[model samples]
Every structure is written in C-alpha cells, then in structure tokens.
Target: MRRYGPAVLLLLTGAAILRVALFTELYLRYVQAGLRPYLVGSGFLLVLLGVAAAAVGRREREPHGEHDGHHGPRIAWLLALPALALLLFPPPALGSYSAAREAEQRAAQGIGSFPALPAGDPQALTLAEFSSRAVYDSGRSLTGRTVRLTGFVTRDDDGTWYVTRLLVSCCAADATTSKVEIREADAPPADAWVTVTGIWHPKGRLGTDGAWPPVLDAASVRRVAQPANPYERR
Candidate 1:
C-alpha cells in the first residue's frame, strides 16, 4: 500500500484537478439550473472514495529502498493513463453539453451584447477582431459562401449536432464557444475535431430558456482529426 501511496495520490489529485477544471462551468450551470442536488450527491461520492483510498494508503509504508517491485510499476503506469488520454483525446469544449443548462444565461445575456466591428482591412485582422466581426455581422456577408472552420462536436436539444469552435483569449478557463449547426443524416461523435466547409445561414429559434436564439445553419459537415494547435487564438 505504501509503495503505491504516492502514485494513487498523484492520480487522484490530477484527476480531481482536471475534472474540476473541465467541469467547473457544468457544475455552475447545473446548480443554476436547479439540478445540483443530484450532481452534488454523485460528486460527493467520488470525493469520499478518493478520501478512503488516501486514508488506507497512508496506513501502510514500504521500507526505505525496498520497493514493492511487483506493484510499483503497475501503479505508476496506471497513474499515467489520464495524462495520456488527455494528450491523445483532449476533452471537447462545453457546447451543447451545457447549452440547455446555460440557456437561461444565454437568454439573460443576449447575443447582441457580443462586440462588433466595421469592415476594414482583412490582413490586419486578429482573432478578437475576426470574432467580434463575425458575431455582429450576422453571417450575412458570408451567407451562401463556403468558409472553413475547425471545432469540436456539440449537440443541441432537438438532437441537432453542431461543430463548435471555442475562442479563447488565454486558456480553456476563459474559452467562449461559437457554433455552426450541421445538417447531416447522421451526427458525428462528440469531441471530434472537424473542419467544415459550409454556407452560413443565420436563423433564430426559441431556445430551452425561452429566449430567442441565433445560430449558423451549416450546409455541410465532415469529421477530421485534431489540429497541431488544439486551442484557438489567444
């Protein structure tokens, strides 16, 4: 137990941190949507399990330099799985997963509040500039025109799938997701990086929060692998 103590602690700590970070918004949105009781209970159970493991591991110790040769490497290797999974298959952005949960937030905030800019030189465009322009421009200028975009998969309430591009100024902590709905016969799996060439059509519908919603109606959608730069423009 002692031989594997550090490894277990490391795995738990890393998992807790990663889960907390990735699901922070989900947790908050769940609470805001009045579904916290169920999620909280489940989350507490996980925490209790982690605590029990830690406690048991603390009660045993390996003699100095006398490694538990059989279990040490196995434990260490198991501890490496999470990091490897993260590298190989990073989690997708919080899109439709939280779309319903955040419907109230979206309604209260409104999409028009997003910054906008007047058309100018494209060469001087930054990500912020492009995003702001894209948000405000109503996709009208680009309507019926095929444009390329890369993002992870997200699903809406109607079971409609979307390719969501998260724009981040820094890290995933502050990422804001922008989405384009895919009109395909079969939806792709969530969290898959995809490059879509689609004609943008702006339309509004009633979201779950009973607010007016605007989204890009995609003409085409396809699946692809992750890019070298998984995170979008800073």
Candidate 2:
C-alpha cells in the first residue's frame, strides 16, 4: 500500500483535474448561482474518504512488514470506473444537438441576423477563407455573396441537405458540426463529399426540430472525395 500510494494519489489528482477542466463552464455557472454550498458539503465527504483510505493503507503497510516498494492490492483498477462512465455515457457530438440548441437560443434572443455585404470581386475568395472570415464577423462579410464550400453531405429530418464541417477540440469525441444548406439544382446524397456554390442568405423560419438555420442558396453541388482531415480547425 505504501509503495503504490504515490501512484494512486497522482492518478486521483490527474483524474480530478481532467474532470474539472472538462466541465469548467458548468462549474462556473453553478458557482455563480450560490449552489456551491452543496458542492462544499459533498467535497468534504470525499476528502474524509481519501484521508481514511490513506490512514488504513498506512496501518496495513506496517503489519505486513512490507518495504516501501512492495506491491499493494491492485487499486489501480479502480481508476477505470471514471473512464468507463465517460465511454458509456459519452456527450453528444456537436451536430444536430448543438445546432438545435443554438437555433432555439437565437430565436429567443432575436440574434444572428447579418448585415448586407458590400459589392466586391467575389471570385477572389475560397470557401474555407470565407467560412473563417464569417466566424469572426458572420453578418457583414458573408451576406449577399455567392461562395463555394466543399464538405460531406449531411441531412436534417425535413429532407433538406447541407454541406457539413466538423470542428473538433481533439478527436471525434468532442467534435462540433456546422453546416451550409444546399439549394442547387443538383444536391448530393448524404455523406457524399461535394462542392457547393451558393449565394449566402439567412434562414427564413425555424424548422420543427430547430436546426441552426442554413445560410446558402446553392447554385451547384458536385460530388468529391472526403478531405484527409475531415474536422475543421480546433
């Protein structure tokens, strides 16, 4: 027990830190709402359990006449519980889930309406560049212009199609999806990689399922192969 104590402590600390970082926003929100007293009560109980475990392990170490380097009961397996929970009850990917939530928020807040774009040489822009620019200033820069975007086809329940891009924090486990509607004469099948040329336009009304309204009046849709890295920028 003594020999493995340091390793177990390190593992516990690492797990706690990782969980805290992943749910930082939730923690901040809770803290602001004066619900921290409950957390404090529960935290004290965990601290007590940790102290008790350490004391019991220390006592057993002396009775066994084991050296500091002796292998103790395999407590390491206990670490798998949190990992298993994360796997079995994983968070939803940032696709329809996030989009629906955002659309609802936008509807309630009356936001997301972009200003008109000034006339310019639209031929100078690529889809990736346009999308990046729109991220910083979605309103004025992307409005009223025909642009081309290439991505895999994704569909909503209403049968409308989109060219979807996934923005990932690390891997698919934490990916978030954004999309542009395809209104071209020829729309590609779902999951097919395609390039779409479209005029940027605001969505009219919320869909029944409340997807983040798309922003393209597509002029063309042509199938292509998937890019090597399907995820968008971190």
lDDT of 2 by residue, 73-151 (tens): 6676576566445434434234444443333221122235445554663433434345434443434466666677776
Q: What is the lDDT of candidate 2?
A: 0.52
Q: Pairing residues by index, what is the TM-score of model 2?
A: 0.43
TM per candidate comes to 0.43, 0.43
* Candidate 1 residue-wise lDDT, 1-234, digit = tens: 534445455555545444533455433311232444554455556556667767766766766777655445544556656754643454654554543343222212223433332444222232233334344443335434445566677776588876665555545455555555566335777776666555445543322322122244445566786654444453
Q: How much is 173 displaced in model 1, in angstroms?
A: 2.2
Predicted structure 2: clash tally: 0
Cα RMSD, each candidate = 11.5, 10.5
